[model samples]
Target: MRSLLSKVAVGLVFVFGGGLWAASAVADDVAHKVVIQVSTDDERTQKIALNNAVNIQKSLGVDEVKIEIVAYGPGLGLMTTAGKQSQRVADLVLQDITFSACNNTIKKITKKKGAAPKLVEGVGIVDSGAVRIIELQQQGYAYIRP
Candidate 1:
């Protein structure tokens, strides 16, 4: 009977202790977060920012990272439908990456061009890209400018 009880205790420990270990492992695997800023009009700079985001997502498993790219000023063009990177942006959006366009920049462009720029599908609009970057940083997201 004592031997039976010892075996039972060992089984319980393996079950319960293993559960706790798994839970702590999941907790330690907290998703990595980052907010990338792109305020340059240079196409090369914009592509570099996109590449940085992709590389980070790849280094960490896609499901283990959250990434947001904020574009304002001259960089706002990168999020527009007519932008050279529009197709790539769309592809990245499908992979769970976020793209933000500044409404303030859109308004300025509208006033200058008589119409607001058309954003690529899945692009989110923020009141200001700078403010969005600050908000993300306050929320513990690492900031990147690439």
Candidate 2:
């Protein structure tokens, strides 16, 4: 009877422990995550990055991937409400692609222009664009610069 009870207890541990391990593995397995960095103010570069993001989503399926675009320096201009590409940015946001603007850049621009630039709706502000890219890379996100 003692041997039988021990065997049952061991089986229970294996069943529960295996279940926990499987759950943890599933949680850690992300399909794909990409962080695209844009530091130049060139409209061509900005448009290329945006096209790359759309292509990635189309190739991988929107639900199978995550994408973030971090803009700083002159690139932050792309996120401004008055930017020529603001409408395109807004459209991309609706598709689950995220856009981040550097707060440091905003401060510098504000100091020079005497006012903070208006950001399009849904644009996130981060303390630093480069740092944000680093953090995302550390979290296993793939990095791209166009």
Candidate 3:
């Protein structure tokens, strides 16, 4: 009887402890990361990208989703002070959505226009938007282009 009880105890420990560990693993996986690319100057496309980010955050719960939007080429305009979606960008920044503007594109525009474009208040500058997107993808972020 003593030996039987010891075996039962060991079996219970493996079953319950393993179950607890599995549950913890699932909870840890609740958070998801996504990166969005905006390469167009179109106002509609820019708004769609922002909408996609918001929708993902809402579907996943604010605390469970990490979102980044990388804008380059003509899309860099989306991160500029005079952008049509500038106010929306500011609001989303408060919600923890990251906005990345390409420095290379900025430089090109600056040289052509004779002045650097003014970025929105919360925009971050990345050396290259394409590279940023690749890095984010390597780090396991899902990518979306709208």
Off by over 4 Å in 1: 1-30
lDDT of 3 at 97: 96
Which digits, one per residue and each the tens of the lDDT, describe model 1 over residues 88-127? Answer: 9999999999999999999999999999999999999999
Residue 14's lDDT within candidate 1 is: 100
Clashes of each: 0, 0, 0
For model 2, the run of ten residues with the poorest summed lDDT: 24-33
Tens-place lDDT per residue, model 3, 1-146, is 99999999999999999999999777556479899999999999999999999999999999898899999999999999899999999999999999999999999999999999999898999999999999999878999998
Task: Write down the TM-score for model 1.
Answer: 0.80
Greater-TM-score candidate between 1 and 2: 2
Q: lDDT values of the candidates?
A: 0.94, 0.94, 0.94
Per-model TM-score versus the true fold: 0.80, 0.84, 0.80
| Model 2 TM-score, all chains together | 0.84
Per residue, candidate 2 scores C-alpha lDDT tens digits across 1-146 of 99999999999999999999899768646589999999999999999999999999999999888899999999998899998899999999999999999999999999999999999999999999999999999988999998
